[model samples]
Target: MQLEEIKETCPFCWSCIWLLVDPSFDQIYTEDCSVCCRPILVKTTISDNQITLTLAQEDDGF
Candidate 1:
C-alpha cells in the first residue's frame, strides 16, 4: 500500500506529529497524542494527489 506521512498539529497538545496516511481511500481512525497522550480522532481525505486531514478529540463529539 502507498503511504504518505503528513504533518499535523495535535488538537490536545498543539504539538506536531507525522501521521502515516493511506492515499487509496478515505480513513477515520484514533491515535494518541505524542505530547499530551490524549486520544485524537484523525479524518483523512485524499484527492488530486493531495491529502487533507481533520482532527478532533476522540469520541468526544467535539
Candidate 2:
C-alpha cells in the first residue's frame, strides 16, 4: 500500500525522525533512533479523519 511521510519524536531520545505511515489504518513498525541509536516502536493510528503517531521503547533488536 502507498504510505505517507510523517515526522515523530523519538520516545527515548526526544529527537526528530521521519516515519512512513499507512494512512488507511493503524500500523506498528520498528525503527532505530537516529540520535540515540536505540530501537523504537513506532505506532500509527487514524481516527475521525485524523492521524496520531507514537513512539515507544522496543526490547527486541532490529
Candidate 3:
C-alpha cells in the first residue's frame, strides 16, 4: 500500500488537516475531525496513479 499525505480542510470547522491515503484502491470511510470532533465521510478514488479525495459530513447523502 502506497501511502500519501494530503492537505485538506475540515468540512465542519474548516481547519487545515493532513490525511493519509492509499493510492492502491478506492475506499470510503468515516473519521472525526481533530478540531471539532465531528464525524466526516472520506472517499478516495484511485486512477492512473492519481488519487482523488472527497470529504463530507458523515450523515450527508442519506
Candidate 4:
C-alpha cells in the first residue's frame, strides 16, 4: 500500500491540516479534525496513480 500526504482544511475549525491517505483504491470514510476534533467526511479517488481528496462536514449529505 502506498501512503500519500495531503493538505486539507478542517470543516469545523477551518484549520489547515495534513492527512495521510492510501491511494491504492477508492474509499470514503470519516476522520476527525486534528484541531477541533470534529468529524470530517473524506472522499478519496484514485486515477492513473494520482490521488484526489475531498473533505466535508460529516453531516453534509445527511
Clash counts for the predictions, in order: 0, 0, 0, 0
What C-alpha lDDT values do all the predictions have? 0.87, 0.82, 0.87, 0.89
Best by TM-score: 4
Indicate whether candidate 3 or candidate 4 has the larger lDDT. Answer: 4
Candidate 3 per-residue lDDT, tens place, 1-62, comes to 56899988999999998888888889999888888899889999988888888999988832
Q: Please say which candidate is ahead in TM-score: 1 or 3.
A: 3
By lDDT, the best candidate is 4
Task: Give the root-mean-square deviation of each candidate in angstroms.
Answer: 1.5, 3.3, 1.4, 1.4
The TM-score measured for candidate 2 stands at 0.74
Model 4: how far residue 12 lies from native, Å: 1.6
List, residue by residue over 6-51, the lDDT tens digit for candidate 1.
Answer: 8999988899998888898888999888788999999888889788
Instruction: Name the weakest run of 10 consecutive residues (lDDT summed) in model 2.
Output: 53-62
Clashing pairs in 1: none
Report the C-alpha lDDT of model 2 over 2-60, residue by residue, as the tens digit.
88888888878888888778899887888788788888988788999688987788974
Q: Candidates sorted by lDDT, descending order?
A: 4, 3, 1, 2
Better of 2 and 4 by lDDT: 4
Candidate 4 backbone collisions, by pair: none
lDDT of 1 at 45: 83
**Cα lDDT of model 3 overall?**
0.87
